[model samples]
Structures are given as C-alpha cells and as structure tokens.
Target: MNDTPGWASPGSAPSDGQQPGTPGASAPDDRPDDAPRPAAPTEQPGTDPQGPGSKWSKEQPPPAQWSAPTGPQDPAQTPPPPPPGPGWGNQPPGGPSGGQGGWGTPGGPGGGYGGTGGPGGGYGGAWGTGWGGPPPAAKPGVIPLRPLGVGEILDGAVSTMRTYWRTVLGISLTVAVLTEIIVILVQGLFLNDYADTSALEDPSATFSELASAMGSALLGSGVVFVISLVGTVIATALLTTVTSRAVLGRPVTTGEAWRDARPQVLKLFGLIILLMLIAVGVTLVGILPGLLIALAGGSTAGAALAVLGGLSAAIVALWLMIRFSLASPALMLEKQGIRKALARSAKLVRGSWWRVFGIQLLAAIIANIVAAIVVIPFTFLAAALSGDGVGSFLDGTGDFGWTFLIISGIGSVIGSMITLPITAGVTVLLYIDQRIRREALDLELSRAAGVQHPAPGTTPGS
Candidate 1:
C-alpha cells in the first residue's frame, strides 16, 4: 500500500495536474477523484490520516455491512413493532417459546410464570376486549334507518315470490275473482240498490223495489266482504311464513306456509277488520269535526280540515302502530290468544313504536304503490269487461255499478298479492327486532344461525 496520500510511484507521470503529498511522487491532486470519502468517522473502515484531508476512523466495523439505519428498522423489515406496550410481541426472558432472549414464555398465565392467571396467558383483563379497543359507540338511528341494499332485499323477495307466488297468488286471486263474480251477480240482481240507499240519488221511491234491491245488494256485498276479509288474512299469514323462510334461508312448502298461516288466520282477520273499523270511525269523526267547523263557516275550513284530519289520522295511526307492529311475529312464532299476541307485540314494540311505525308505513306505502301501479290497468279492464255484463245498470253513471264491484274486487286481489308479502316481511323483521330487544335476539340469532346450535338452554334475553 502507498504510504503517501495520493502519490503515485515516485517517477510516474503526474495524474490530473497534481500536487503530491510525498516529496517525490506522481499525483492526482492527492485526493483520488475515482474514489469517495466516508461521510462520518464512524462510517469509515480505517483511519486515513495520510489520505485526502477527509477524516476516517480506522476501526469502524465496516459500517455495518449495509446501509445505515433510517427511521427505525421499518416494521416490514423488523418483527411487527413489538406489539405496542405489551409482550404480545413474543415470549419474555426464560419463556417457553423459542424467542431469541428477553422474550416471555408461551406459558404465561397459569402455573408456568409470574403472569396473572388470565386466559390467554397474560393479564386477560389488561385488554378491553382483546379486539383492540373499547367497543365503538353505536350511532342511534343512523345505523339501520337507511334502507339496506335494494338488490339484496329485492333478491330475497324475488326468491320468496318464486317459491310462494304460485300458491299464494293463486288462492288469493281465486278468492278475489270469486268475490268479484259475486259482486257482479249481486249488482245485476239489485242494479238499482245503490241509488236508493245513496245520498246522491232521488229520495222518494217505491218501497218494495227499494227493499228488494237494498236487501240483495247488502247481502251480496256482505258476503263478498267476508270472503275478501278471510282471503286477506290467509294471504297475510302465508306471506309471512314465506318471507320468514326466505330470510332464514330455509325452503318452505306453500302448504307449510298455509299451515303456519292457520294459527294466526282469525287473529289477522280480526285485527285487519278492527283496523278498518277504526279507520272508518276515524274518517267519520275526522270529517265530522271538519264539517262542524266549516258549518260555523270559517274562511279557513279547508285548512282546518287538513289540520284536524291529519292530527286525528296521526293519532289513530299511532295507536294502530303500537298494536300491530309485531303481529306477524306473533302469528309466526306464537301459539297464543289474540290478546296475548297483542300484548306480546306491544311489549316488543314498547320503546320503538315510532321506528316500527315508520318501517311499517314505508313497507306499506312501497307495496301499495307498486300494487296500485300493477293493478290499475287490470282494474280498468275488469270494469270494462263487467260493463258488457251489466249494460244498463247505471244507464250512464259511466254505468259502473256491476263494473265497479268487479273491478274493485279484482284490483283488491292484485293489491293484496303485492302488498301482503312486503307487509309480512316488515312485520316479521320488526318481530325479530323485538326479540333482539327483549330477548337479545341478535346474539340468539347469531347462535341460532351458527353452524351448530349454541348451548342448549341458553335463550337470548336470558
């Protein structure tokens, strides 16, 4: 090795215009342009006192054989950052695992070492949930209020329809058609009845004619109404069974849905009929109040009507809401009396009536709108067809006596098919929710829905 800084052999041609450090050497400015100087004393392998003016350490360990450390041995390069403040990192000193020293043993909790007898070998209580942190605060309505994926929900509905649409739709439609036929028959039998009874027609008439027409129409309509009511109840029950089965991913026979529907048939009918009565009563009272107010002849009768009707309807609606929110669940899951079912529904819907109401209304409105869109044209057709049957029933009130009845019945059936499933789905879901609230249904459902059932008698709420 050359003793001089950048001095070439004493007699060699000078390199790069040089000044040599030695008394008689060729030179490249004594700085050697081809090589580089170490930045720090600790970075250089050997001291270079006789080299370029740069300082270098003689015993620096070859600068770690790699690039200097920058920003902590990157987590990717090092073992996942010591797992924060605890030794989830590795086994500590004298530990069982083959961790390079200072790592704890795998037998940390029980009899092996000084760990708290925590389940996973460390202080189990030391972590909030071992899931990383405190449970996130549940946002109130924001979590579930938004409509879920339409495609998913509709897909479930479509599947339900596929399995159930045949029997349910067929039965409901048959009942509807039968009712419509009866309505047309009765309309033909007593074509003059509506005018006699209605306030819009002439008052004085022949008594026998009026009596005959009125009696026939009343008997006829009553029969149709009863049939329609029964049909609707059956439809609701069946739809609920189908919807529940769909949600649970279990296939059900239409016969099974019908069977399940049997238990709640009368209850559903009674409930619906009761609601209808209340609605009629509400409309009467609501309209009466408006009329009375208007008879006082205020300049604001319309507004008063709008306001009063709205308030009254709202009250009635709320009551109905509290009453029926859990009806389907009651029907689907319980084998009890109407009063008990109502009580169960009430209890389940206690604090969440408004939510249930909103959801129910949403389901109803959506179903009704969809049903209406589907049925309106069919209604027109039925009415037109019936007009041919009762040519002069109204002479020309659009002559819609028999036509109206027939169309109304047919439209009702179409409406029921579309709406019943949606209503059932909504009610059943609410029922499940109530179960969650009253019975911890979420956890229970999680368990029930698990691969194997959870512990034998570990019911949800319990």
Candidate 2:
C-alpha cells in the first residue's frame, strides 16, 4: 500500500522482496493492505512530490548507471550524479537495504543527493549559512534613504560640507564677509563714538541722563541686531538650497542657489519675524500681571511673582521655538508661505519635540564650541593691537576703534563661515529625516536622485 499520494503501485516487484517473474513473487493480494510501499522515482530535482510523472515499468536502469560515486569526489570539480535509492531498483552506495549515501542520507535534498549544498552534498551538511541577511538601505547621496540616527544626521551634514566645499564655503565666506563689513561700518560710523554710555557709570548721574544713555545704547544695538538678522536670513536661504541639492548628489553654484532661494526669501523673513513676535509677546504677557501689581503698591511681592512668571514664560517660549525650528527649511525647500510653513513644521515636530530639541541643542553646542575656539584667539590678539593695549580692552573700558573692530570682525567672519553651513545643513537634513520617518519621503528622494527604488510593498529581493 502506498502512503504518499500519486505514487505508482509496485505491481511487478512485490513488497515481499521478490523481483518480477520470480518463483517466490506473491500476488498483490498476498501482502497485507497496510504494508509500506516505496514511492516512485522522480525525474527532476525540486519537483513536487504529489505531481504526475512518467509511467512506471518493470524495466529499470542498471545499478552502475544510477549509483552514486564510490569515493568522495573533488568538491571543486563538477558535481557527480545523484545517488541511487529504493525506487531506482538499486541499494545506493552502502548496504543492500540502505546506508550512507542512500535514500535517507543527511545533507541531501529531502535526505538524498541533489540539494543546495557543497560539491555533492546538501546545503545543511557542509558549509554554514547559505546567504547573508537583507541588504542595507540605499545611500544615493550624502545620507541614506531612511530614517536617520543622530550620528548619521550629523555625519550627513559634515559630509555635505566636505563633498561640496567649493560651493558651501564660497557662499558662506561671501555672506559672512559682507555681513561683517556692514556691521563694522555701522558700529564705527554711528554707534562707536556717538552712543555714549559714560553716564551709566557716573554715581551722581541724573535720572534723565541715565534714561538718555540707555535709549541711545538700545538704539545702537537695535540697528546692529537688524543688520545681523538680515544677514542671517539671507545666509540661511542660500545654504538651504545648497544642502538640499547636496542630498541629491548634485553640485550647486552660487548663482543656482541664489535663483532657487530668491523666491522664498521674503516668506522666510516673515516667518522669522512672526516667531520672534510670538516669543516676545508671550514673555510680556507673563510679566504683565506682576507689573500691574507693582503699580498698585505691592513692589516686593510683585517683583518675586514677576521673576517666577518670567522663568515659566521662558520655558514655554523655548518649547515653542523648538517646536517651530523646522519652519525655515520647510519654507525654503517647499516654497511655502509663512503660516503654511509654520503649520508644516509644527506637524513634523509634534510627537518628536524633545528629540528635535536635543539634536538642535547638540548642533548648537558643537557649532558654538568650534566658533569659540576660532574667535577667542582673535579677540586676544585684537586687544593686544588696540590703542589702550590688552589691559584696557580686557577691562571693557577701551575705545573700540577701527583697528580693534577690523581685527575682531575678521575673526567673527571666519567663525560665521564655519558655523553657518553647519547650522543650515543640520536644519535641512533634520527636515528630510523627519519626512522620511513620517511620510516615506525616501522613495521620492530616490526617484529624484535617479536611483531605482522598489515600489511600495516590495523589497530588494522581490
């Protein structure tokens, strides 16, 4: 009786070990119905056991024609024929019944020869793991097309700067030099000698004199702050374009970057102003109650409450700032308006506020540390070359004349050159990474880069 389905019955050669046409061969009814019968031989490797095959006949190939090789064949050479088994009318290479290199031999496909393995053996017998695991994610450019870790994000920024140093450094250096020149000119012409703070140092100074001095100082600082803010906005817009191109493994010139960034520069400026106003307004609201109390003659208690309120407002402002940190990149890269960009950044940063904050803080710390290393030395040197010498400069009483301003401005320019690219690159890369994690933006990036990415629901193997 055959246990396996679709196997031909061994009619000519009975199950009682008698060959066809022999005297001891019994009729089919002589053997019990439940007795085991060997399966019919298959013609091909890896064929389904239940599928149809060529008809079985009493005739069979000779033992030598179907038997396995006697000795272990050289694995490097061509593989030998598959070993013979019961249905092939041969006892295999061992005992007459069955033994090594026979039907149940280990390391062979389905416990026989002709399997995925070494020379003549099956896969599991000789060597270890057949193939390695799945492939790594695609990296068509500076970053891989997947969600990134912190180190990978930072490395991508640095890699972009290094790979396209000509464009990156050229843009950064030009912007930094122009900004420093304007700042130096403004300080030297309007604030250096005209805005006097000497009244702030006088013990007998009248209230009006102190107020006038303070107002002048604030006006000068406001002018410088506005100039610096404009410079920062321009640099950010340009560098955002550079970094986005670098991620596609494309090189960009200053002209190309300018053309791309020019359209959205105004929107980016508006976004920055709106964010600043929100922060300032929140801070003012926090202290408003205390100011009202102080006007009603509760000065001591009002001061205490104001300090507490200010600290809490600062924390809230910081949270809002981090939450919206991605707006500039969104605005520049997506050509979004101020409100839309702010909403987009808020959406991307919603669940990852702390993570975004940590990365931004880390980048800021690293950029500042590097800038300090480059700037502090120039500051000392500038003091040494100034008119009052290092002592007066260190004491903060020296006149910041052209010599001091020029020397120190050179240092500031150099510092900005290094830090600007880093900060801009990190911001852009963080935006890309967030999109990759949230929206599977890597597929679009891969297509944009001309890399062949698998379709959705498919893998590299498929």
Candidate 3:
C-alpha cells in the first residue's frame, strides 16, 4: 500500500505526449496557415541500428508472457491492484468496477483499504465535495473537544457524576451530612424560641412584639443560610478538581481531589463571601435614600421609592451574580485569588452574558427540580411518621420536633448528595466551554489527555 499523502488533479493529459503543466508544450499555432512545411525524415530500421553499450535495452522476452493467458484461470490466484504509480491501479471514482460509495470503495478515488486499487490514491478527488461533515472531534472524556451546546453542557455534568459516582457521592454525602447535623443541632439547642413563630402570625400582635419575632426569625435563617453556603463552597471546591480531571478522562480519587483543591478552599470561600457582600451592598445602597426618607417622617413617599429602588437594585444584583457565576470554578481550578478570579470570570463572560446566564439558569432549574423530586417525598414521609402527619405539616402548624428535624435532615442530606456534584460539574464545564470558544482550550486539553492530533491533510489514525 502506498501511504503517501496528497491528491493528483483529475484532468486529461496534453496531446503532445506530455502531462499538462509540464515544462514543454507545443507552441501556440500562430504560424501562417500556408507556411511551407519541411520534408519529414524517414529511416530504415536496419540503418538506424546502434553499436554495443547504447542507452537502450535490446533483450527480447518470451512471446507468451507479453499477453494475458487464453484459458480459464483460478479465481484464488487473481492478482491485487498494481502497486502505487501514475493512474493508481487504472480505475477512476465510480468507474465500472469501482463501487458507488465511501473512500474504501473498490477502485474508487483514493484507493482506500478494501479497494481493488492499491491504497495509494489520495482523497483529492472527493475530500470536501464528497465526504459529508467535518471529522468528529476528539472526546477525551465527558465532552467533545469543541465549544459545547446547552444540552452537551448538561450531559457532561451528569456524565461526570455518573462516571465517578463513588468519589463524587462520597464528598457530597460527607459535606451534606456534616452541614445538616450542625444546622439541626443549632436549631434544636439555640433557636427553639425563634422556631415558635406563632407570635408573628397573630393578627393583633403589638409592633414591638412583631419586630422582635421577625428579628429572631431572621437570625435563625441567617445561621442556616451561612451553614448551607459553607457546605456548598466546600463541595464546589472539591468537585471542581474532579470535573477538571474528568474532562481529561482521568479518574481521580477523593483524596487526590481534596489535595488538589485544599489550597484554594479558603480563597474560594472568601470569593463567595465577597460576591454575596457585593450583591447585598448594592441592594442596601439602593434602599438607603428611601430608608433615610422614611426615618425623616416621609413614610408614604419612602415606601414608593423603596419599592422602585429595590427592583432596580435586584436587576443589578442579578446581572452581577450571573457575571461572576463562574468565579468559584475559576478560583478553584486556576488557584486564583479572590480579585483575580473575579476579574477572570468577568473577562470570560464579557461577550457571552446571555449565553452564560441561560446555561446557569437552566442548570440551576434542573438541579433544583431533581432535588425537589427526591426531597419532597421524603419530607411527606417524615411528616406522616411524625406526630403531625401530612395534613398538619402542609397546613404549616406542625411542631418541628426532634423526629421531624432528623427525618427532614436525612432527606436534605440525600438530596444534596445527588445535587452537589451536578451543580459543581456544570459550573466547571461552562467555564471550560467559554474558554474553548474564546481561547482554544481544547488543544490544551487534548495535550493533557494524551490525544495525538493528526497531521494536516492526513487522515486521522493513518
């Protein structure tokens, strides 16, 4: 098989016994039509005979070897196509003996494997014109080496979770169980009074009583929110490492993921807190003027301004949130500081705000839906097992006793075990997709994955 690369153009030879485009060709017929012609020279064969050592071979071959055999021949002894040379086995694309399709078609252009023609003809005849789409991309792991679509991004996330479920679930379950235990203990021991929120529900409560109840409730909720955020931060940090390796088709143990992520954990936590504060600060600034107006006895005007300002602030916050949504992955994967990670995220998100927003929103919706599907049934079962039963729980009057707390916390833990990896994986994959579109990250990933790119103009795996 001749494996040399390149295609010969398909055109007829010149009439002057020379290939077209060769150095010599008959001059254009510009001579006068009636110009005199020289007498042609003729020689007798014996008169032109040369002496010994002439630049020609004079040996004669056996007469029968010059032609094909006249009798029937054994099919098993049929010869293969002639070795690679001009015209590459004397067949053209779709010739009488060549099959109709594929590079491998017998006697087709580019004498591919399985063809009667020797495998020397290059794909010059039908590369772009006949070969359908571009070649499939290299897929080292969960995603192909290209800019990802929405479904691909989601699928990559789920694939990462499924492919490395043991390590992924281990990290998530540990973090979730620990976080939930802390929350339950804190609520049971320190917030029992705040948990009894009936005082705020009373229609005739005094303003001071209502204010106190709201403050206590806020305190309880703030504690829970902070705990949840910490758990999320830890899970994101570890899973970032796992997902990054998963992209390169590398399997990582939990210990390895932890070691890789440990250095960046504190910085990731700080970045998350900073982003939260920025959002909250914007919100506070929006309502500050209205708050001042209200304190100065302009209550009606203050309320209107606060509503309008709050909405504008919310819009700004949402924009900022989406803009910095990738910061966690950036910080973890790049081992970047809070400021640098935030800057990197903003830079990557510059031209693709809507795309990033839609992907993030979609992932969140999917993760939440999955979590709700798992947690809701467990919650109802817990309620029924508790003294309140399902009706009282739904009515919002059930006491959250130890039974309720433990049962509901178990549901929360299980739900988080399923969801944490997915959310983290999607965020990491989105970061990678953006980098691929903007910076050609796929080449780097291919190198890391040990994928060998084919040489230009050569078939892959040739």
| Model 2, residue 443: C-alpha shift (Å) | 0.2
Q: After superposition, how far is residue 162 of candidate 2 from its true place, in Å?
A: 1.3
lDDT comparing candidate 2 with the true structure: 0.75
Summing lDDT over every window of 10 consecutive residues in candidate 2, give the lowest-scoring window.
90-99
Rank by TM-score, highest first. Answer: 3, 2, 1
Tell me the whole-model lDDT of each prediction, alpha carbons only: 0.53, 0.75, 0.75
Q: Count the backbone clashes (under 3 Å) in each candidate.
A: 11, 1, 0
Model 3 weakest lDDT span, ten residues long: 3-12
- Residues 373-422, model 3: lDDT tens digits: 98898888889988988999988888777888898899999999998888
lDDT string for model 1 (73-141, tens) is 654765443444552333233334332332333444333234333334444332332334322322121
Backbone-clash count (model 2): 1
Question: Model 1, stretches more than 4 Å misplaced?
Answer: 1-80, 84-155, 167-192, 195-230, 270-314, 382-396, 401-415, 446-462
Q: For model 2, state the Cα shift of residue 447 in Å.
A: 0.9
- Candidate 3's C-alpha runs over 4 A off are 1-129, 195-223, 453-462
Summarize candidate 2's per-residue lDDT along 105-193 as a digit string, tens digits: 34333333423233344434322233333446678889877778888888988998899898889988998899999999999988987
RMSD of each: 15.7, 12.5, 13.2
Each prediction's TM-score against the native? 0.51, 0.66, 0.68
